[model samples]
Target: MSAILPPSQRLWWKEPVERIEIVWIAIAFVWCLILTFMMPYWHVFGKQNLSNEAYRTTPQAFAAKAQAVVDKWKVREVNGVPVVKPPAGADIYLVGRLWQWWPAYELKKGESYRLHLSSMDWQHGFSLQPVNINTQVLPGYEMVITVTPNKAGEYTIVCNEYCGIGHHSMLGKIYVVD
Candidate 1:
């Protein structure tokens, strides 16, 4: 007889479910309930949730804002990229374009600043290492996050999305001073 065929014995449907099967079913239902509640519970009390502070904006306008910060606070240039040192509590902007994170930032330890991020040409991922802050950088929209660095060191901002052939070269930096 084929495995797909029903059992030749009669009255198979009349048998009661085994005790072990009932216990397994109960366990699975309880697990499903726990999994369903965990997401909302974590969002209410999680320390590392993604910020929901984003807005629709044109790429031109966003670029203007980023350029204003670069022009005002640019202290130096490294590898042809501007390194801006905006004051604590001020706004800072980072732009992702073609293959780079433009105009790196210099921040002071324990001071908070509003950080704005946007993409100029394509979608990108903003991943700040050592601090573990990751956000999506989408074209024509701005993502804002408040950051307060607690340690004094150099941090790296790497693109976690594949943009193009030069995706691997798209790296940025942030310097935190005590």
Candidate 2:
């Protein structure tokens, strides 16, 4: 190796050989990221047709199952209290108003609640973080998402989709297990 050069004369990072190595490394890193997303266990993204692959069940086999959930999800309430029976599972709901949540909704330990989410006005994003998750709550249309509270702690439900000036502070709390 040659003696260390002054800052102005240094060429270690710009060598042609090192440049090629960096390119190859970048390519390999991107390829690994693509593969990691396709794996079944990681459902954060690129998890296509989850039920079919995870349960080994075809579309036809799931007909009854889908109908069952739809029937139960048809009825819903505004806040923690249920207007109708909440299908015996974990449920999430989002508000269309900016910087506001219903303010209170608590989950019980081990017990599950069915999450029925929708927007009262415009399209809103319902995110249950610490879980790396989000779901769209569209106006006049309902989307039902199910969650099981595995860990007991405080979690934030923030709006991931842009709404207004208060978008950053649009947060709510979920206490799992009490």
Candidate 3:
């Protein structure tokens, strides 16, 4: 037989060290690209400068006291039917439950209302955000709250304070209309 040559041999330039170096260079390039899009490659944390005060009393008492200084609720007629209205300039309330809220869908599209809220069980949070207001709803007492729908849109009502096990999921929606 003549001299035989095996084709299984590799080129000398295809070295293991070169392959490892190439992989490391590629990983470094990808890390740099990712860091360019990140918020901070190097930075410092800052602290607040102002003082904040805490409120202890419920907003319902504040609202009632504040509104009482201005006006009071009275019995009136709507389309000849007797109704309870806000003191000339107040919001309305749709019934809310433990699981959800049932807004007053029986009224006209742009009607307003005032809520005299209370609970039968434990203390609950009555919060309407973007308005910077929250009230503590207590048992056996009607906590009146005021809201005005300046714009017709969908708003969220979040319970800022915890209730029980289902605390985080406690939420409601408000539908304002023209």
Candidate 4:
């Protein structure tokens, strides 16, 4: 009765499949089609989807822009890193370099900011902890995402990509205050 028998001894093709088997196969095919259509549908209508807003820019230009923002609204320096507190609704920049994320950010709770991210030398992974926002940072491209901090606390920015020997030390911070 098994189909795996030798071809000379078995005529499995002549055997009729059961009605339940045919019904199951049809159900599976329809389910697959439904699942295939759901992917693009959710991507177009989902509320918590990733932004497709990005642009091309050089590393030097991006660094300059980030430095300017730092110099303009830097409240203080912590361990030689500037902690910038740009006003809500302003543009905020974060740069990923060889082994660090430059300059920390301070934002107000419930206010939105346009966060621009880029890398200097290599591809980096930007993973904001606690809130769990993850994105890829490229060297020659600038990626922008609008973020609103809904809670007041200290959040850590961890580089999840392995760049070099010091990758484990590549960390940044963001402080959200009321």
Which stretches in model 4 have alpha-carbon errors above 4 Å? 1-22, 25-45
Candidate 3's residue-wise lDDT over 1-178, tens digit each?
2235533345735535677888999999999899875534332232211112222334355445434522334344333322333433454433333533323222223444455555445566767656545676665455454344565655566766677887667665544555
Per-candidate TM equals 0.81, 0.49, 0.41, 0.82
Please give, for residues 90-164, the per-residue lDDT of candidate 4 as tens digits: 989999998888889989999999999999999899999999988889999999888988899999999998888
- The global Cα lDDT (0 to 1) of model 3 is 0.49
RMSD of each candidate? 3.0, 10.2, 14.1, 3.1
Off by over 4 Å in 1: 1-3, 6-16
- Give the best candidate by lDDT: 4
Quote model 2's TM-score. 0.49
When summed lDDT is taken over every stretch of 10 residues in candidate 2, the lowest stretch is 48-57
lDDT at position 80, candidate 3: 35
Tens-digit lDDT string for candidate 1 (20-44): 9999999999999999999889889
How many clashing pairs does model 3 include?
4
